[model samples]
Target: MNIKLKTIFTLLLVAVLGTTFCFGQRSNIYIADKPFVQEYSIKYNFTNERVTLNSVVSDRNGYIQVLSSHGLLRPKAGQFLFPGELVNDVQYRPTSDKGITDADIYKNQIIYIDDKAVLSNAWAGNLYSRHDLPNAKLFSAGQDFTFLIADEMELNLLKDSETLWEGSLNNEIQDIKYDSENDHFFILSAGEIYSFSPKNNKLELVLQNDKLTCIEVAGKKVLAGTSDGFFEFDAKSKKHISQIEKNLPWPEITTIKSVDGETWFGSTQGAFKLEKNDKFSYYASKRWLPSDNVIDISKGPENSVLILTDAGLAKICRKEMTLFDKAMFFEKQVRERHIRNGFNATVSGMTEGDVTSGSMETSDNDGLWTSMYLAGEVFRYVVTKSEDALQNIRESLDAMERLYTINEIPGFPSRSFERRGYKYHDKKWRRTEDPEWDWKSTTSSDEAIGHIFAFSAIAELVDDAQLKSKAILLIDTLMATTIKNDHYLVDWNGEPTTWGRWNPEYVNARPIMVGDRKINSSNYIGMLQTAYHFTGKEKYKKTAFGLMEKHGYLENLMRPMSEIGRAPETADDWSRMLSESWNHSDDEMYYCGYWGLYRYAFNDELKAKYKEAIVDHWEAERPEKEGLWNIMTAIVGDNDYDLEEAIWYLQEYPLDLVNWTVKNSHRKDIELIPENFREQTIKEVLPPDELRISRHNANRFDLDGGSDGRSEYSAGDIWLLPYWIGRYLGVIGEPVQK
Candidate 1:
């Protein structure tokens, strides 16, 4: 349950200067920097062989670096500088028998920096790091592929793009399945909840409290869910019998859902419906909502139970309400049942030659045919005559056109932007780098631009005239190269930049513990509002109305409230309403500047100044109980499902959530949902989440503001700021009397 905090990017651990200049420069010049860790003691011999030496490691802040490599040396006093401590002339590639021969890894040594001290290149198993040096591949993949094994993306297991037995929750896990006789699965973390070994993931902490957040398994009974209420333990006397109480017009809780006893909980102060005399009642945003800020609800597929919130997926049904187009036809029967089992859902790479799995791979295999690029464009647009929905849109589009490979190149060219330190994801984005070294810095900016806006939203939702003219010639070849470089983009598509060169120092990123730059170009005018609804292009709606009027959005007019395509809304306010000046990491830049001024900023006193910057950012940071019920009391489906505002901000805003291990960006299409609104929508795929705080305590809070992780704001900042205060400014997809 990780959502809250909207800040971060403070030099993010700093280090990446050297703007440009080179030579023997001593591995590049006398280094007194870059050795956070490079140890290897095990013996007296040569940690294999391939020598080089230079030494120094000071850090009172003078910050310097040179270090070079080949591998194996230790002469700084005990200084064993072997191979005649090479200065003797460069030209060597020794030990080609695959190096390291156990003197306990031949005392494995390989660190670098030369012009004067701060060097060693001993050698053992993998420090191939040396593209002519500079943070020599930053800590040169040392300690055998970097290792920090902590930082709040913890409580885990890898591999999720497609199963190790249906695994899928990296942050929405709420288990408890005891299945028939004795099979187990009961999880929950951070404060504590474990029960594992469901066939060997192993763990057994039964239950510890601090207001547990989720856990389920109904039959043998074990349903937890809490902020203040819900429990049911019974896995063979690990006893807690049944606790239920705490429920009202607002007591908290978040999510529960049980089936037989009919329970359903969802409570950050709203949603409830118990029955069986466990009696709970209470559910509004007005007779079953699209917002009250709920996070996840499950119970779907027939009697329906999918809800999600903060304002997106909804499908209640009991009293009536099931449309986003039948939850995009229950996300096209769960992406045609995961493309009939051949599920790819790729995000990174691994298809090999001519590439595929959408190209680029050193082997992190990010395979996605997105159930066939989203049921082959929802079978050209619902009207499905079913042949299992045209056999899952012809095998998820023959696996997204052979996966990935139609012209690709880059072993380097800022190959993932100077390869940086590491965060280079491996959960899949088709891994290749960032096993988690940390991240130094460089650039590439918007290289793939979320697979070119999900391949231009699958060629503009099926009207694929040559894949929408090859996604408008690849969005004008990435606005003529990564949005025309404003030092890696911040302006060039008509002012207000920050979308193209989005740098969170990519590696294998866990990002978003508290990072902000607010999701690249905060809804980069929804890429000129999807190229002004595909080619209606008034220069893509006047360069997305000049990036929400020179990029500052809801500062005065151009969006905040509503007036649909504008009118005389407020004399165009401009900076007058200073409800504490404003910032939720720039509220996805005023929710994409009021959805690019309600789908094209026509002006209604600037969408009531973007609707009074959402009730003046809750009357300047929530003016009392409306203090947004202490900063948002409900509606949370993802940003890690906010465990009731993460245990009341780790007991009142403790902060800390910087876990960047990014490489390739793994997000194998979970459940997208949107085929003209799938029969009216109600999809639920939950089963991969596991980050219950502890990627080493996920940065140990204190992230008071410095994040840009999740790379600051991109779940499209939960739809350009709750589609203007949640669905076209309330009424859940508009209509209370319009």
Candidate 2:
């Protein structure tokens, strides 16, 4: 009876997410490849060569093998194979299953080879018999999608595992980072650098090639160290474009890391660096780094560089690199580039649904920028959690301290240098590296902002005067360099429209007494609150008052004018000019495109204005999806709708609820923004689907319009935030894992 109940509940879950209502009735789209099996204690069977797996393994060669859950095949030496007809290397059809490819072997059901195996890595489980790995801790677990894990049984046979990974000496990984932007990991293995997404149920082989010395991912490039020398590979095409063999003084390339638009590699002799143009330079020994023999490299914000050497972890930073300095970096890139492809098609087209022509950008989410922010948040969170992150905080503080003591600041007080983050490039946007803060320029301000956030987080967690003082120095420089006017901050550099609005000059330089009611806005309101806590700077408050009281900033909410405060260009245009406003003042919570911005909004006025905007927008668009004539299902989880109206909207934007719920563990009101919908009208009644998604597959032409942009973090920002918030506030997430 219990089993039957479990089965029934599972089917109900499927029904909740599977169906959509078009007019008044439900329309479920999924016609399963086969009916749901309900046999008791089913025996293992491999009759069909290909099977849809609940979980699987991924491998390097791009080909995957499988272990059938219902097959009689047993495991051997960590190598599990399909029980039935093993197809030839060339074109071959599966003996039984339809559309089964060599790559799909591991993608199919996990054939448990051994029971009670515990060779789990932090990212994936056991790695051998079952594909039970965990998602990489460092990478984001994107909402509304499911990715399987690879087990050891498959790993042992997939690639050449003879050599121990460099970071693992008793087989323990040093660092495991999954780049959700690029969709791969930076793994340290037995003296070699391995870059790959987990192959949960895949089997392919790569014979040994010892020439490889280092491997790293820089934007679209994959850098590798080889026998002859070093080379950069195309991340998409997987083609080796440039190579310099035996170029390094040292023979072995120990590690290669991507940081700030440059590729840094470590070898037995020392450390070396590479620019996007493939220019090679050395930074090893006491002169550039502590030791020539480098073991690992981790790049952090504020020109901070972490190098793991024979002498332990060594951190290097230019003393001047600060929050104030980073805006210049954004200014430089925005001045040089003009490429926008992600979601262009969707916005322009009136088709029921479709994708826009947007190229994948690198920094769409500003990982580096967010990293700086998150570092501060983490600093506070972990410190408050009882010294959990104290070691990290201490080490980070110590590193900065060294840079301060050394007086190694970027040369430019106003200018800065930074890597082109997640930005797609065209020749028109020919991004040229700024020479001023190129190599040793003193980066500041934003670095100060970062320090302030970090230090404040630390201060909140633990009273640390040294950290507080360091943050203070950063603000002092920012105030000195950034000229203030009319409750706004103008850029220190000369006039230029930029990206990310890191450029202060462009940010603060809104034409006053302007035509078209020039609405210059920013999220600096949050920063003001942040700044007031530490600096007690009344200017921060004054700036907030200027924007709210003086500019009539509330009028521009969703007006198609410079919104989001980061870009002036429409979805296609690079609006760095607008982005700068966020740095100068607050009120940016609205532009963030997530529920948390609204939910956790720090500034009360700004928060209220944003809520009005969301509600107003909801009211305005509520009718188009449908009038208040439908039943709200899992599909329509928004604030502006009653149960019936939201149901109509769900019918209008019917997504594959069953497939969606099965895939992702997250509640998807709109990516992470779903939390905001809890108190909304549609949420009061049982939604039609099992879960409601804020953002759905984005393209008209594509079969499934899941997010396509590599860098567009806003892709599901509102969706996920609402969902997470909902989970937090009893809206929705996954059911109890147990």
Candidate 3:
């Protein structure tokens, strides 16, 4: 359900009413009492010294039976889907001060040697052995059958003390596991595997390999762990099949387990999964494991994989959908809820009356926000050719074109629009002073850059003649106004807007080290190229070349970043402005402007220079893991660009879009750096939507604990843009549009 908080009821009821809101019909101004809050079904259970998983078994009914020192935990069917539900735990503390001595289960029965001789089964049997078996280290049970490996390498198969078969491998054994499929006990010694069958009272050699560590049976294949690699054999014919040693991240495999045809190998370094097709996937990041030294691997509920490390246990559930599924879902969400006619809704982050479920109402940067959405749809239509995508682009382009006309000025675009009765707490939304319509004035250069970026994409991609002409006209008007008004974005007040300073005098006045110098050069050149390419206006092309050759705009933009920021000695008015603080917003402008920079460059020489500049900017930005930057970099033909990191950014992004209160300042896991600008700490990306509401320009590492914990941010714009862009670039494949 889509929640749009059009009005605020009260602050006291925010936590009580939850993040979801019920709203009336669409209105010009929708006031929110708080931000939306999203609840996550995912959870993490951190195990400590008192709680540790030892062994795990999956029943036919899909219940995961966990054996631990604290007790045996049996999760009810479907427990993984529901949070806060308790699993059925049978209490039995292990007697060993260090760990469980022996434990195993088979055929709906179990037996173990903890402190005392203990046994359990469906028949309600209370059995205990009087003899002291202090050296017993392994146990297994099957339908009225039990086995124990004790003292030296003695193996005893017993039925009520009958001792059906007793023998010793005569060498110290490493580990043992019961292969229920063959109803036999597979034992591992220093360098070989032996299978003992109770049905025939016979011990047979399965296979021989050096430095054997562990073993597992998977259908027709027998997997053995060696000191340096993995060995596979044909289980039916006992024939050697293959050996794998090179690709393993860690060779000394301690345990091997299989689930749904995927085998998991646990080693001291971490765990690796061998898929059915024989491809390997590694899991070594601290985000996934409490400790990399894994001791055991077990089948978990809901097809999840349970890993017991030396420090704690982790349950990895494959719950996230494919990137394609999420991208399509976000596209639909943006289309239905985010797009207010053509203006993308943006809420004021500082407002207190925002609703928890809906988008924030704002009269700022609507053109910029909508332009990004428009570009996403343009890419979407290019790939999928869906009518919906085309229609969306048309609507957004119309809205953007309206920005130019809604105001009295011929080429000036309004920041945003609203109905008369609506006003924000900060008074940022002003009346066009028109009777029925209210539009914001004093739009910034960001809006203009966004308008040009989207307009260029539409003009180049959309097949509709009418839409293409309108896009070109808008570009011509915007560019002509800038060129005619002394290369400045004149505002309603007749003074240039604070951010609209592109005049060569103003841009060239700044020291080359200032970010404004390079940003203005890059943005102006990109804009002029876009206007000239779309409208075939010679003046646009001439002015662009004039700035490049006469003003050294090209060289200014190509300045080495090392000289960019050397902290201002004193906070001048310009230095104190938020835009001057590394001005991530400018980064957003530069990358978005790249479409025009390279794609519509004046010539091949200039195009190559633009690519070089973009690469330099991207090289500095790679550490941040900002998805849009990586995707856009790849789009510019950097095939060797970290495409995997692009996928990681998409996958690791949080599911919750709410700017929740997340605190990492005191966490032990984060490696805090000694810096001044932001809270730069190295840590795993928090679960989706768990972090603060971050703009594309914000640093990925900055920790944020939201103000009121109510705002639900719109992640659709950020995610959909790159996802569709990836699809268009062939880095990501397409999905069936539903």
Q: Pick the candidate with the highest lDDT.
A: 3
Give the TM-score (vs. native) of candidate 1. Answer: 0.21
Model 1: how far residue 19 lies from native, Å: 41
TM-score of each: 0.21, 0.31, 0.62
Q: Best by TM-score, which number?
A: 3
Tens-digit per-residue lDDT, 619-687, candidate 3: 877767677887788645635566666676677565444444554443322455666343345533433
Ranking by lDDT: 3, 2, 1
Measured over all alpha carbons after superposition, the RMSD of each candidate to the real structure, in angstroms, is 29.2, 26.7, 13.1
lDDT of 1 at 366: 17
User: Which of 1 and 3 is the better model by lDDT?
Assistant: 3
Residues forming the 10-long window of minimal summed lDDT in candidate 2: 34-43
Off by over 4 Å in 2: 1-369, 372-386, 391-493, 500-522, 554-738
Tell me model 1's lDDT, rounded to 2 decimals: 0.32
Residue-wise C-alpha lDDT for candidate 2, range 310-362, written one tens digit per residue? 43333444343221122223222222221122111012211111112333232
- 1 or 3: which has the higher TM-score? 3
Candidate 3: list runs displaced more than 4 Å.
Answer: 1-300, 304-317, 346-356, 425-427, 567-581, 665-673, 676-693, 703-709, 734-738
